[model samples]
Target chain A: MLPLSVPFIATAVLSVLGYVVARKRALSVAGGDIRTLTSLPHQHGLNTALSTLLPPLAVMMVWAIGARIAARSDVALVPENPTMVYIILIGLAVTGFVLSLLRISTSFRARTASEGWIMGLLIFASTIAVLTTVGIVLSMVSETLNFFGQYDFRDFFFSTTWSPNFRGDSDLGIIPLIWGTLYISFIALVFAVPVGLFAAVYLSEYAGPRLRSVAKPLIEILAGIPTIVYGLFALVTVGPLLRDYFAEPMGLGQSASSVMTAGLVMGIMLIPFVSSLSDDIINAVPQAMRDGSLGLGATKSETIRKVVVPAALPGIVGAVLLAASRAIGETMIVVLGAGAAARLSLNPFEAMTTVTVKIVSQLTGDTDFGSPETLVAFALGLTLFVITLGLNVMALFIVRRYREQYE
Target chain B: MTDYKISAKGVQVYYGDNHAIKDVDVQIEDKTVTAFIGPSGCGKSTFLRTLNRMNDTIDICRVEGDIRIDGEDIYDPAVDPVQLRAKVGMVFQKPNPFPKSIYDNVAYGPKIHGLARNKSDLDEIVEKSLRKAALWNEAKDRLDAPGTGLSGGQQQRLCIARAIATAPEVLLMDEPCSALDPIATAQVEELIDELRQSYSVVIVTHSMQQAARVSQKTAFFHLGNLVEYGETDKIFTNPEDPRTESYISGRIG
Candidate 1:
């Protein structure tokens, strides 16, 4: 750790010393008159510090990547000595600091020089974020391609069965998983949308300030709870309640774990997402719109229903779509409440499992990476990613269009 | 007072701890344009909202005094604010058309009040209201277009049309021309003059010249008090309260 941190600490200390020493040199160059200089002393100091840090950082980054790749390929990178690498890095920092200090004359545009380095740093930071997302998608794509190479693509997509045995000649179809995903998500949305929207309306339009201030944060607290806890809730309380009261009495099914259990629990999990976002969107509808409606003799409810809600409809739809994507991607609640049985059935009380649940079950515990079952998780992930991506884009489009209409 | 179209006596308005409107009394006549001219924060808009009980919507706002429309106490427990607002319509400082088609914007008031018996009747009411508002010619072709797609001036007229579609007896306008350009302002002023032939039009304006041009009666407010009330010409020309004179001559706001 000391050997690793040594170069970084040296670079930092040198940059600080460069800043103070360069500022003094700049003042001396201007004959102690700041007004005679093209840039302020602080700007000259910043230029020196950035120049001291940037070159060594870039070299270190390149060296680290080279070392990683070389290790993977069973070869040592150039500049094999660790001390030699540290020497090169610290030398570069010293050279850059001295060169910038000498260049900080009375006519030097130090501000622009510092600004360019800062902009480059910002660009590097943003590029890391973008690269991470791109890297994830690329990895998924590679594994999915490997999956398709071994398993017949036609059977994986078109066949309804999803039985994966460790022995050969096992079926690895995705249709039933996709069906379960959609069915559960649909039931969740059906149960959540109206209840959430009505809650949003009550919070935004009818609830008094005291009630709103108390109730809003309490509802948002649901969003803060972990999905695993909600899974427990589904397992312990709602699943048994539904099975004993409704499913057994109606002769639908006797199983405690069913699609309805997971769907209803997922709906409970999603209520805060829908209601909170819808509340904000409804609140954003200008008070002037409500006043216009009310001034024309429309009742408060009438004003909300006819004018305010219509104006906020696009944003609410966007919110619902976002919640739908979340429901589709959910894993833990379905794992506990809906037993892992991939089946395509219209009866919601039947045991079922979603794509996310299967992906977890496929990849967890002892699993060889060479097998189709293991790689299929990546395929399921990529499919779910694409679906959610499409939904997010559509949601953004609607929300943006709504913003333009009002603003 | 009974003969007046609308009457207010000793009206006081408060928003939480802030006294927005002090003791004030004024009577508005039927089929006449009455202008309330004052500087900003003088409570002209607040008083206008009280005529239709629009202040009831503000949770912190409280109104005290006698305000009557057509010899009926509008603040009475038996008088529903929704029904009272239908009888006494209002146009806002900024034109706020419902985010709907032009035809739907005008039809909303009549639809909720159940004034139209059928489609043709609703169409006639919309057409008549648009024509009355002087928006018929420009908006006729694009009745299906969004009301927000119109220019600022056309949106104001659309609001006026929406207000009068309920066939209200009084129209309260809070600085209707403040957001319009000069040409649009002139058109709205001309439309206001025509609207006075049917409904009692009460306008609150910051511009004294607009008050003189469009109103038959003028009431000047200063520091939440009614300084003077009489004919528009007398209020503008003759000797009156010093504050009213200062406001008119641009010596003081």
Candidate 2:
């Protein structure tokens, strides 16, 4: 059996015990009437659970780190087969933690301990989640810093060449990847925004009840389809069709794996995202506004073009931004459809690679942690995170402003 | 020939299977204020909407028989509802100003109909329409402010201004005073009376006193049918129909 960490096991035990005690105390205080308590007994129990678990979890983490460091120091004295010795020490430490948990569980009244124990456990659980995110950010930042130490920051930012193989000399600049990402996303947006907005306008304003019921669900089903399925379709169906029909006949390119191929597939993936959001924002435009416009002799389309869209402009912008973010972060379609050769070109017929593709390539299969190649993935990840976060923040701001205007 | 601006004959309206308005016939004279007074769901608003074809917006709503503005059959296949509405404008029950500047709100219809050739002409029409609605003096300084920023009464007047900017021959008002305070209602009522000097006005009102105050002619609807329609003085004091007397007395609405 895989041994569990001692602190995690102890936290679970203390939390349960603390909860029982807190519940009993709260119920007794309420004269055994559960409803008489200010809050639900479960909330009181949770408060106690969080208090109990947090303190011991913090102590355990510090102890575990110190123990590992001391073990490494002791292994340094042995001078012979340090790696094997370190692995053995880690195994011993894990076993000791499991044994400690087993001993703690066997004790009596363990299910009715202090209320602080339950509160501690809850707090510890939340901290674990928050700390995990912080840990990921720190790890990515540190590795990215290491990558920047080797490659010039200016070259990474501005240079448009990206051929990164572990030969004696390899160029690894980020601009080509950024360009590919932006180009595919731009193509996707161009295809999505108008079609989606029109569909949204039609569905919200023009469609009768029967048509709306059928069309709205059908559009949502587009979003429900798996991204990998889209990837496969792009690879097998669209790729060959483009090659035979357009590329070969026009003499645009020799190969099927092209930016246009991936972009078209990505655009199809983003249609429902744009449509659904645009539908919601359009629906949010008050009925009174439509009535007012229509009442004034404006036809339905004219009303939509003049008043409805303008009223919902900020919301539409927010929807497009959200869709743009989704398009940028899309990975599988680009991975399968767009060939991984990060060449900066305006031609959609040419093959391109994105930051996501590079990150995937760097991390997959056998990866050497010490190498600059693997570390570069961390930098790409950080960049992807920042880009998506900025897009989301801007979308939120626009949506909020739109709502404030109406309210 | 009768100096009528709008005429309806055997007009029946249905929302899905439910008949909202029964067979109703009414004639509105040129440059006169006509009031439709009835209880809620008695189809006063529905009948008012039929004049401008505003009911076309509702997918479930269906209108049968004839409604004409200036002798032109509004429901005819060749007759564009947009153009018909351009000639016979409407103001809704609630104050629904577009989320636009006051000038733009008034200029919207004129711009859509291409009534103005240039900016100065559009400005002149806007100022004239606003003045006619009796809102120009209050809103003169803030023509650029959002129409929605105005008070409830001012917003209704702004809507009236918006309607008049198109220079429509007839204006249909479905409870223009419903959302306003007494002072605002009085102002709108006064404006409605003054509007009779130029445009034929059809107003749907819930208050008997308001119909008496603003309208020259009043039509009383009961259930979904027009029970009585005549001069405002005759309907209020000595009505021919028993339903009209009961409605006016507040016995049955």
After superposition, candidate 1 runs with Cα above 4 Å error? A1-41, A55-94
lDDT of 2 by residue, A1-407 (tens): 11226446655676677667666666666677765555655655655565555555565554454444456466433324435533444444344333323323212132344344655656767877887787688768878999888777787777778776664255778889999999999988898899898899889887888999999999999999999999899889988899899988888887777788888998888889888988998898888888888877888888999999999998999999999998898888998888888889887877887889888887887767667777778888899889988999999998886564542
Residue B28 shift from truth in candidate 2, angstroms: 1.9
DockQ of 1: 0.76
lDDT of 1 by residue, B87-185 (tens): 999999899988899999999999999999999999999999999999999999999999999999999999999999999999999999999999999
Evaluate model 2 with DockQ and give the value. Answer: 0.55
| Candidate 1 TM-score over all chains jointly | 0.94
Q: Rate the local accuracy (lDDT) of all candidates.
A: 0.92, 0.82
Which candidate leads the pack in DockQ? 1
TM-score of chain A of 1: 0.88
TM-score versus the correct structure, for each prediction: 0.94, 0.84
Clashing residue pairs in all predictions, respectively, total 0, 19
List RMSD in Å for every model shown: 2.8, 6.7
Measured against the native two-chain assembly using Cα atoms, what DockQ does each of the candidate structures obtain, in the order listed?
0.76, 0.55
